[model samples]
Target: MRTVLDFTPLYRSSVGFDRMLDLLDNASRVASVDNWPPYDIAKIGDADYRITMAVAGFAQDELTVTQEGNNLLVGGAKTGDDSGEYLHRGIAGRTFQRRFELADHVKVVDANLTNGLLTIDLKREIPEEMKPRQIEIGQASSPAQVSQIDQGQKAA
Candidate 1:
């Protein structure tokens, strides 16, 4: 016997969360788990993030970074170890797949592998038109309007 978890009910109940529901649906089928390569996700700034994975045994050529739709996929497959002549192969040199959920405007800037660490940078660009702007409040009176206010105050 198997248990099936239905999320459609919850998704329909959620308000102003259609995109999030879509993300959740996509994540449900995304490639994750079992292939758990140790990783760290850090928010570098208000709109910037960094994903660093400890891929020690994997080389730059072995690793691949790509974006499928709105998801970032980091995968690696160690190659050409056909002889299998390792007496003590403690290090993990097998294939791994990692998926990251990205926001609507988030994009992968770049990925680099150095000293066994694979670092992927992401940036969310809020457009000038979308960014919040401050409105300066000044005294609401032109020279003519100020005279009228002064006269009213004096009369009162």
Candidate 2:
């Protein structure tokens, strides 16, 4: 089921929230029926994530995993020997390429292929400057101290 959501009302009221609204508007336009080389995305830890792809009938050399900036690309190209005849041919042998958009500071830590599955591990490493930390509140200067400082400045 799909319904149109008009962001006109939000645009009229909200400020500095256009990016979030754009994301919501763009999300609905993405195709929901793209299920080639099925994959699963899971959050394994607070800042860790896992993307496991069911890549049966594909070899390690045939698959290529690349990370460029905020984008992750996973591609598989079946190499050599498709000449053999088959009756049923149930197993899929089509080449596939999937792209994943990663958040800021999210990096691909490791990737492994085992038992017909490809698993990619991602960890979000927030920079020290970006991570939330408590700011030490300092005591405000008293009126007496301010007046003394002003007097000292005048004397100088």
Candidate 3:
């Protein structure tokens, strides 16, 4: 049985969370999709993440990784064909495409394939203008300085 959740109440109380809510809804809708070429997402540091996917029987040249806005796409396609017949085929080499939605400011840093495992590194880089800054408070001006400003105004 499939369960459905209502987000209307959440929307009524929260503000600036539309993207997160939409992502949750989309994940629920795609929950029944195929799980071919299993993958894992790990957090290495405060702002660093890694995604590893099992891509056995696929060559490095046959795989492609791309990023569009806040979305990351990984795809694989078999290059060579099977000319000989097999008595029992067990290995899977079918083409697949996976989509991952990333948070704001998150970017793809590097990607590598080793031992049939494809690893992708991601990092979140906050811009200088967007980073938190300290504000300096000013104290009241001295009475002498205020008086000098008034006298200068009268002379003018």
Q: Best TM-score goes to which candidate?
A: 3
How high a TM-score does candidate 2 get?
0.80
**What's the TM-score of each model vs. the native?**
0.68, 0.80, 0.84
- Compare the candidates by lDDT and give the number of the best one: 3
Backbone clash pairs for candidate 3 read none
Better of 1 and 2 by TM-score: 2
Give the clashing residue pairs of candidate 2, or none.
none
Poorest 10 consecutive residues by lDDT, candidate 2: 26-35
Tens-digit lDDT track for model 2 on 1-156? 788788989999999888778878977878775788999999999999999999999999999999999889999999978887888888988998999888879999999999999999999999999879999999999999999999999999
A best-first ranking of the candidates according to their TM-score comes to: 3, 2, 1
Error of 3 at 112 (Å): 0.7
Per-residue C-alpha lDDT of model 1 across residues 1-156, encoded as one tens digit per residue: 434456688866788787877666665764535646899999999989999999988888999999977789999998856686878877877898887878878999989999999999999987788889998999776899889989999999
RMSD of each: 8.2, 3.5, 4.6
TM-score quality measure for candidate 1: 0.68
lDDT ranking of the models: 3, 2, 1
